[model samples]
Target: MPRLGLNPDHLALAGAELADESGFEAVTISRVARRVGVQPASLYSHVDGSADLRDRVAMLVLGEMADAATSAIAGRSGRDALGAFADSYRDYAHRHPGRYEASHRRTSPSPRTVDEGRRHSTLSAALLRGYAVPEPEHVHAIRLLGSTIHGFVTLEFTGGFAHSAPAAEVSWDRIVDALDHLLRTWPTSSTDV
Candidate 1:
């Protein structure tokens, strides 16, 4: 019999907190059950297992990040919008490194849809629309933006940019400007000369 007031959402939410406190790798059913003051077996009723719980946590984090990014970039457009989006993403990644990692995890959407990724893509597409970017160029532009943001952030998180200069802020601004310029004049098929 399931415990009264215990549920999947409660367990998943608690697991998310555990992830924040101990890192995603440390999150486990046993640990979560202990944190929740429930027997480890009790958790099985709410979650199928570790993978299901982890996926739920990932989805929650992704949704939160999407919401934050969406709110941050609202009422903005063009480079301003892009800057807001990029800055917001970096901020979220820095603040919630574990959740940020989960947000970008490549997984086939089954019970957990990556709607947050879709929302983010919408924002990126909107930015591309402002640039008049066409077909493959637009897709490439979006990937470029995503890669630039993720690459910088991931490297910084892992101390890969330890000895660099110009500061993250300066580099970030320059990157945004570079992206803006790239989007504004996305190289078409005939531009390879």
Candidate 2:
């Protein structure tokens, strides 16, 4: 017998909320059951277990990130698009720190997750089109961009900049500008030189 008004999606949503309230590691079937006023066994019908629940949270986070990235880069190009794309990631991390952390977890691939992952890649490639990065170098460029954004956001999110002199915002703008210039002038292969 399933509980009324409770399903996989609802449970997943509750898990995500719990992840945000505490860390992702804090999300457990027992805790979520308490959250929804049910016993731990009651959630078994909705989620396979803790792993399945975490996978659902990962999928939800990825989907939300893809949607935000898509919206952030729409009708924009060049540095404007680049900044917005980068900011979208930072904003999402700040807004949903736990869900953002869950996004880094490896999960079993399902159709929805695969599609969301592809959409993120497609959006990145599309954003890169505004710069002069050759197709061959796009993978490298994407890695650089993703690393830079992730590194900066992680540090900022974890109070790494608390003791800094200049504001993190100032550094962020400079970093984005530097990325823009670097992408615009992406170097050619050594053989071409």
Candidate 3:
């Protein structure tokens, strides 16, 4: 019989917490088992293996990030939407580093990837919508936003800019502001994304 109160979701949540404290690379079945006060073998009943657990963690993180992005950007549009969306993501990365890392590592989501993922993508795409980007340019805009946000977050996590001026928060705000301006003035192009 399965453990009534213990399952993939619980394990993933606990694992995410562990990731935040230690780092995403530190998350593993053994470490999570230790945190949950269960035998390593016991976790096998809930998760196929470390990979499966990681996938669950990624899904959970994505859901959370999607929610945060959606909530923060409500009643907003264009540059307003862009900054709000960026703030939501930056806040999530700061608060849940582990979950944020998990979110980036692609996991073949449990069927909802297409649906749930669309909503998440729309957060940025909607922001881009205000910019009047041409057909193909819109795609580039999306990739640009992803790269900028991820690159900044990754660097901040690794202490890349911890010793710099303007602080990480300030840099994030400025980056979003710049992206807003760039998108608004984006040139029409047919460069395939």
Candidate 4:
């Protein structure tokens, strides 16, 4: 029987906290069970194994990031929306490095996890609406937007910019401004280039 008062959420939360402190790689059923004061076998009732635990943590962080992005972009548009959206990712990565790392995990194909993943794309698409991007180019715009933000955030998080003169924040603002400009003046067709 499942342990009383010990649910999947509890386990996932424990896993997330462990990940936050020790790094995502440190999260394992045995380690989590030790952190939560339970035998490793007890976790089997809540998670399949290490992969499931990682996926749970990934889903949790993704949901948090999506919610933060949603709130950050609310009542905003265009460059404002773009900056706010980008800031949300940067802030979350800075605040929760371990959980942020887990967010990149190849999550299982559970419907809930899949839906949670879609929230990011939906949020990006909504933000894109403020720009003058053509409908046909929305996919490319979304890919570009996600790649730029993710790349910068990952680099900044991993100390890739530690040796730079201008702080990462300076470059971040410039990148966002450049993106806003690009989106505003998006080429409608290759012939226009």
TM-score for each predicted model, relative to the true structure: 0.89, 0.93, 0.90, 0.95
TM-score of 4: 0.95
lDDT of 3 by residue, 43-81 (tens): 999999988888878888888999998888888888788
Model 3 alpha-carbon drift over 4 Å, by segment: 190-193
Q: lDDT rank, highest first?
A: 2, 4, 3, 1
What is the per-residue lDDT of model 2 for residues 84-185, given as tens digits with 9 covering 90 to 100? 999999999999999999998899878887887888888889998899688878888889988999899889988999897899999999999999999999
> Which residue runs does candidate 4 get wrong by more than 4 Å?
190-193
Best by lDDT: 2
Clashing pairs in 1: none
- Residue-by-residue lDDT tens digits, candidate 1, 1-193: 8988888888878877887778887668999899989899998888889888888888788778778877877788778888888998899988887777776656557745656567778777876777788865766788898899999999888887778886777888999999888888787896633
C-alpha positional error of residue 84 in candidate 1 after TM-score superposition, expressed in Å = 0.3
- Give the CA lDDT, 0 to 100, for residue 160 in model 2: 99
TM-score of 1: 0.89
Tell me the deviation in Å of residue 150 in model 4. 1.2
* Candidate 2's TM-score: 0.93
Number of backbone-clashing residue pairs for each candidate, in the order shown: 0, 0, 0, 0
